[model samples]
Target chain A: MLTLDRHTYEAIVTHARRDHPDEACGIVAGSVGSDRPQRFVPMANAERSPTFYRFDPREQLALWREMDDRDEEPVVIYHSHTATEAYPSRTDVKYAAEPGAHYVLVSTRDPQEVEFRSYRITEGVVAEEEVQVVSALP
Target chain B: MAIEVRIPTILRPHTGGEKAVEGEGATLDELLADLDVRHPGLRARVVEEKGGTNQLRRFVNVYLDDEDVRFLGGLSTPVADGATVTILPAVAGGAGGVAGG
Candidate 1:
């Protein structure tokens, strides 16, 4: 149900690797026209944590505002699995309040072996889907 | 032999700001008990309930080396000598705003 081009996926993998050992978080914004259901604008996460990440709400709001200015909405919310697989954790499923938003997981433990997976997590059920990233913004 | 456990940022407050600590235990439970002796309230925060059936909060994640504890037999997983354990939390962006400002 979600498609991310190759380039976008690589970018996320790079970010996740760079933040190795620590959880890296971000957002993806895009316009959902009739032709394409997904578009993305990735943003960095700036929060201090020992064993968890907390997305800066203010930064997210600003991003949303910017997307609104551009007539687009935030389509996805993403983060990394530092030493884990690209699967949704129990907490991830429980906190996924936005049903419309795609949940992306980037595994950074093995950057060269990076895996990008998508999910529609709700009420502890995470339904994964394949995604394709494109060359240019769509 | 004793093993070293890496303390995550959230639990740093309890561990007296030490990023990693040493414990004398052959299993994960023994190591955690040893850690609790030095840093009280840590076991309660990391392990939820009395029986350790569930993890504390959803945000917290524990890993032995690069493997997640949830998928690696939960807390009962064995720990070898000098193995490294890491903990991380789930952070995501939503309808909220910046971190500090």
Candidate 2:
């Protein structure tokens, strides 16, 4: 199960909504070995396509370096699906290089309702997990 | 000249879990070839053979110092002694061809 504080949850939802009709992507970083996510980093979708998303190569380098410098890892790798359900698509599964991260998928298909879910995509197998939203992290 | 190649977490298995490995070469291509000699299969993950020519994979981000190799000369990017080469898998994905989005 993936546990997220209310603020972080809201931040992810808001970013997804703000980029509706196009895919939005980002990562939540936390101390290495800490499953808890403490930083929200929204990234530019270089593809900027409604059906595709990619982090700018240069930005990706900087992001990885920052995480390394802080002794952190990507606890949560997230993206939005403007028209589909909150699930990993084939494209998503194929590019899941971080076998240790919680792959979060948010859907803004319904402006009134947001579908938030998490999964572990490892070695071509994707297993969905429960998302527990708490008022704050312990 | 010896270049220090920083391996990402996903590719650590090929490096025997060593985060950084030393390689020798004046160009990126030669460096990868040398890496594969020590860490078998490491080169295959980052470089692909296309139409009888070897090239870096599109999704693997390789940076020489702080500059992305793609913006430089790609596999032919020149490398100097003591340069830091970091490899990162791009964080990317989206709807597939048949998936509605």
Root-mean-square deviation of every model:
16.1, 2.2
Lowest summed-lDDT stretch of 10 residues in model 2 chain A? A47-56
Misplaced by over 4 Å in model 1 are: A32-40, A134-138, B1-101
> What is the C-alpha local distance difference test score of candidate 2?
0.92
Q: Which candidate is the best by DockQ?
A: 2
What is candidate 2's lDDT per residue for A1-138, written digit by digit as tens? Answer: 999999999999999999989999999999999999999999999988888898998898888889999999999999999999999988899889999999999999999988999999999999999999999998
Can you write out model 2's per-residue Cα lDDT over B13-84, one digit (the tens) per residue? Answer: 999999999999989999999999999999999999889999888888999999989999999999989999
Q: Estimate every model's Cα lDDT from 0 to 1.
A: 0.65, 0.92
The model with the greatest lDDT is 2
TM-scores for every candidate against the unseen true structure: 0.52, 0.97
What DockQ would you assign to candidate 2? 0.60
User: Model 1, range A1-89, lDDT digits (tens) per residue?
Assistant: 66766666666777777777777777666664432434445555555442355664444445544655776644667887776778877
In candidate 1 the C-alpha lDDT for residue A119 amounts to: 87
Mind sharing the TM-score for model 1?
A: 0.52
